[model samples]
Target: MEEDTDFRIRFSSLCFVTDHVGFCGTIKSSPSDFVVIEIDEQGQLVNTAPSKLISKILPEPNNFAKKTKLDLQNLSFEEGSNQEVSIFAGCSGADQYHQSGSEREDTISDGTSKGEEQTVDDLGTLLDEKTNELLNHFACDIKEKWNSKTELIGSSPEFSLGRILDKNQRAILHSAIRQKFPFLITVGKNSEIVVKPNLEYKELCHLVSEEEAFEFFKYLDAKKENSKFTFKPDTNKDHRKAVHHFVNKKFGNLVETKSFPELNYSAGNPNVAITVRFREKTHKHRKRSLFEYQDRKVIYTDDSLRLGQLKGNHFDIVIRNLKNQINDSANLKDRILEAIENVKNKGFVNYYGPQRFGMGRKVHTDQIGLALLKSEMVEAVKLFLTPEDLDDPVNRAKKYFLQTEDAKGTLSLMPEFKVRERALLESLHRFGMTEEGCIQAWFSFPHSMRIFYVHAYSSKIWNEAVSYRLGTYGSRVVEGDLVCLGEDVDDEHFPNNKVHLVTEEEESANTYAIHQVVLPVLGYNIQYPKNKVGQWYQEILSRDGLQTCRFKVPTLKLNVPGCYRQILKCPHNVSYQLKEEHDTDVKMEGSHIDEATLSLLISFDLDASCYATVCLREIMKHDF
Candidate 1:
């Protein structure tokens, strides 16, 4: 064996050397310079060998390193100076020691300083080993996790191996890397999880894009030739094949089977809602002239040609015709004047007012009257316009004659007679007037029609006419804790004189009179005195400082069937006044107070006169 002098090297702030030995020949600078180690000490020409080189070799996590320390040391003189150097020692415990400065420093070791430097140098080597071990640990774990040769535990969170993969590492070589899926795929603020396994389908859809999924379902439906599709586990494979074909044909990509079920079941599709608006037009009234009257001082359309749609000239002829028949007398002139004013200003044209024709409150006019006017007009038109007269320019137009004749006939003859008759009768009955035709004719004017319709259409009057009518009453006092009026009180001959007047029998009797009897209408109630009838009578009657007033038995009685009795009596003459009986009945019903009313003790701040007056008004509004 050959002995060599000290040989040294340094890396990552570490330094080391072999033991000193004697060597005869001078070492030459050469590119092929190298240290060779062998089991047989005599094998190589190299004079020295180093264990330091073997210790410096890096452990490979992914693959074994081909180059050894001896190969690195043997580089040629020029090549050594220009060579790329790499350290491969495993990480050591000292590597955890933090560097002194904030900025990173180079890993080069210094060899000149002896004792103090040696400690730091060894520390550097330990640090290098520590770092190498750490890096190797991570790399080995990654390789094992991403081993595609074995099946993965799919449900494990660690299946996402890319999360731990270093940025500098290439992921393409590993098929086991988990695919990334966005948690949300909405254009708006909404979010949803996308777990689709089909890469093609996933690529087509955004995490939020629902359209692609819809299209996928539609494609499935179309593949079935527009047939209604029902999916079962057995058919899933077939369905998946069909889907793959169609998606590939249309989208230039194959879709995975797992996505089919979800896509088919997702919400149908989104639709837009639209709204439209419109505007309405308003209407106005129309008027016409009847005729000229009193030698042209006034006009009259009422007799022959009323202003309603008649030509102006035709109207004038009608006036002349009427005057001619009257011999142009003063009486005729006056009648014509009245007729003209009534038709134009008073709304009497053709016996139907302008107010009655349109949508407004129809001037209540009898259909019968309108029909009569139409018949009159038809007769007049036929009388004046002979076939020869029709040849004149004014009367020559057969169209106008035909149209006007048809209108007149429709107004007069086409309406069902029964309907017209009922309408007229109703109008008359509403006004509380006679429904006789003669009576209707007398009140056929527009003014009268206005009043007639208003009264006819009033709901209150009609309801009452068919209902109970309350009448006047008499004043009486309670006797022996009860002043029982017989159920036959409704019978006109029922004796009220025999019932003892409480006012007359003052000793031990409650003196009561009609302090003010209230009348009430249906569905109403009037307040009454409590069960303490004596206090009611004393307070309502004597409190006013007078014992009595005009006590008269009312002329009418309750028409309703029942044992009607006195339910309550009020002592507060202050609130009592002359009132109708029905009103009192209504007020009593409403308050649950009757002649025998016992619940209330309160009194109104009123005197007998005022109470009587107020009560009377209430009665009129209600009972009467």
Candidate 2:
């Protein structure tokens, strides 16, 4: 309903089509704005027919306008074509423009001039106002259309359709209007719908453009349905369950030693240390740590036996001596026997008593030595062992050190002795004396003996090897663990103090030998002919009768002035002519002999040095 200056172009009598249907007319401008078009029966512009004299035809009255008109002409058909058409007009000149509601109301006041011929510009202004009002209403309606399900954000036209129309929006709108809702209206400046049904309920494949239809179907098929609920198993829960099973089956409620008995198996009470007196054969009396003695012979002593220093290898001797001095009603021999069996099955029978020996202490030695001591004392203890006690203290300790094969296929049972060595070092550090004597006093306990044996052996095996090499200012090691021993030079200049000695017997290694093989090389030989002369070459040279010889001439000096000129100048020389005349006499004399026979006597030495000298001096002498 709007128009622009160029919307309906005027050319004398005809008004070009400007509406969606390009119906032309004989409408002329009367200085007013209304268009009076003359549309034909089919709604096409009526072009003026041509006269006979001008048969070639006047460009057919606005051919450009006619083509555009033809495009819109199909819209007015019986089935209505179901196609929408759009055209543009301007208020100032644009095809579309907005107007305030107040401005639109003021324009409506000119009712009296409605039927009058308004200029094209005046009609365009009115149309723009009406369209703006429709657009506002359309935007509000579009929001209501999507509100229930789509969570619409605004009633503004800007929200109804995006600011710029993309291909998909245009295609969807075009298809939706044509197929689903023919009455659907869009009235905004951009012509976007205000309200429409949600069409997602329909299959996506039905609505997309032909090129995208297959992809849309695949998209729908790929969107999987969600599960109602799910739960992933927790692996931590299983580990805890496994730990629970192990605790129930293996460790029970408390950790008890497999090789030791319950604490109450001794004399109904724990044994405490006792001191005794002894008489010598010379009638001397003395107090001793021995529990039983005869005539000061000290047959049995608590400290010595406990520390594994008891003299005899017989268990009965010690047991009988203990019995001879028992308190009135007790059977001491039986008690001693019971204690022996107790230690044999359990770990500790006698505690390492107060005493010291060797570079370190003998208590440590006793712990290691006593376990392997199968004397009568231990034999007495062994007599009481049941087959079920096969894995008793002695056996278990041996297995821990990997001395016995029983430790295979189980958690590591033997304590790593190095760990014990560090612990002993720490214990020794707390004694506060550097002289090492104080350590000996407290080190003799049976318990210390056990701990020390493990620690000492660890120190011996794991400590660095201390071997020395040569020539270094301090100790030189080719490759071995050793402390750098500082140096001093001897007066004799003999480098004599380089001897390396093993600090401990434990440091020695077993010996073995390896052997190898070697090879040598000798001198060189050369071969040469006795002479430089070639015999077959000389024989050929000697036979001559107007003989020709082919010489290999070098090409390098040929460009020099003398080379080609020398051949010409040779005959021109007087020396060459005289030589020829003098040779005539000799030539005549030699001719008396047969020419073939004389040819053999005409030999020349053909010296290589003489030829080389002549070629060098005459032909190749000049640089140019």
Best by TM-score: 1
The Cα local distance difference test for each model comes to 0.23, 0.21
> In model 1, where do residues sit more than 4 Å from their true spots?
1-501, 511-624
Question: Pairing residues by index, what is the TM-score of model 2?
Answer: 0.10
TM-score of each: 0.12, 0.10
Model 2 misplaced stretches (Cα beyond 4 Å)? 1-444, 447-463, 466-624
What is the model-wide C-alpha lDDT for candidate 2?
0.21
Tens-place lDDT per residue, model 2, 1-624, is 122222112111121111111111111111111111121222222222111110011122210111111122111211101122111010100111122221122122321112122332332332345543453455445435444433222111221332223323332333332222222222222322222222221222223232342332222212222211111122243433443332222212111111111233344422221111111111133222221212222232111122222111210011000121223344433433343333223211010111111122212332332222212222211221111223533335333423322222111332221122222223333542232422321232234333333332222211111000111212211222121122221111111122222233313431110000000000011111111111222332244210122211121111101000000001000000000111121111123222210000000111110111111112111100
lDDT of 1 by residue, 569-623 (tens): 2212111111112212222112323332111111121111122211211211111
